[model samples]
Target: MRRRLSIVLTLLTVMMLGVIVTGLSFGEPGAAPMDDYFIENSQSESGANNVVTAVLFDYRGLDTLGEAAVLFTAALGTTLIFRRRRDD
Candidate 1:
């Protein structure tokens, strides 16, 4: 019963995620004013020659930091999962 309930819950969660993702539409009107602003002024504002780098490291620094933290946590979790256990 528990296994069946878990399976049903998993399916429901996957379906919900699919619906949510499908509902998200990119390139709608006024969907991305930031993109235009970043492309136009990233180099001037951040003082970096590369617009992409300036945007990533300066304009979106906190978002990049969050990504790094998530990657680090995932890596740590994977390492811990695969590490050998020693009985001392």
Candidate 2:
């Protein structure tokens, strides 16, 4: 039973490593249509000079806010967890 588990785990590890190597060989991904759209229209639609700023604040405002909220919550939780409590 132990030998079987070891063999299975080893095979799984090798398969995962093979997948990673194969993925890396493809190099960087090509841009999608959305990238072109954002580059072209971000300034006119969002009125931001910077494309990145327009995308983050205008195009994906809610998503950015949600991410910020999640990060803030995580930080607060970590702070609370590690806070020193002085027992009276």
Candidate 3:
């Protein structure tokens, strides 16, 4: 049983290593058209000098807000859980 388990684990490890090597060899992906659009119009449309800032704050404001809300909720929950309760 132990020998079979060891063999199975070794084979899985080798397979995973081969997959990683293959993925790395593919290199960087080609840029999408949306990337070019953002680069060209972010400044004019969003009125933000920085492309990244424009995308996060103007173009994708709602998505960014949702993410912030989730993070804030998580932080509040964590604080509530760890806070001390006063027993009078």
TM-score winner among the candidates? 2
Candidates' lDDT values, in order? Answer: 0.91, 0.93, 0.92
lDDT of 3 by residue, 1-88 (tens): 9999989999999999999988884435535788889999999998999999999999899999999999999999999998999999
The ten-residue window of minimal lDDT in model 2 covers: 24-33
Model 1: per-residue Cα lDDT over 1-88, one tens digit each: 9999989999999999999999997777647988788778887899998878998899889999999999999999999998999999
In order of appearance, the predictions have TM-scores of: 0.59, 0.66, 0.64
TM-score-best of 2 and 3: 2
Flag clash pairs in model 1.
none
TM-score of 1: 0.59
How close is each model in CA RMSD to the real structure?
3.9, 7.8, 8.6
Q: Which stretches of candidate 2 lie above 4 Å from their native place?
A: 1-30
* Better candidate by lDDT, 1 or 2: 2
Error of 1 at 84 (Å): 1.9
- Among these predicted structures, which one has the highest lDDT? 2
Backbone clash pairs in model 2 (N, Cα, C under 3 Å; residues 3+ apart or in different chains), count: 0
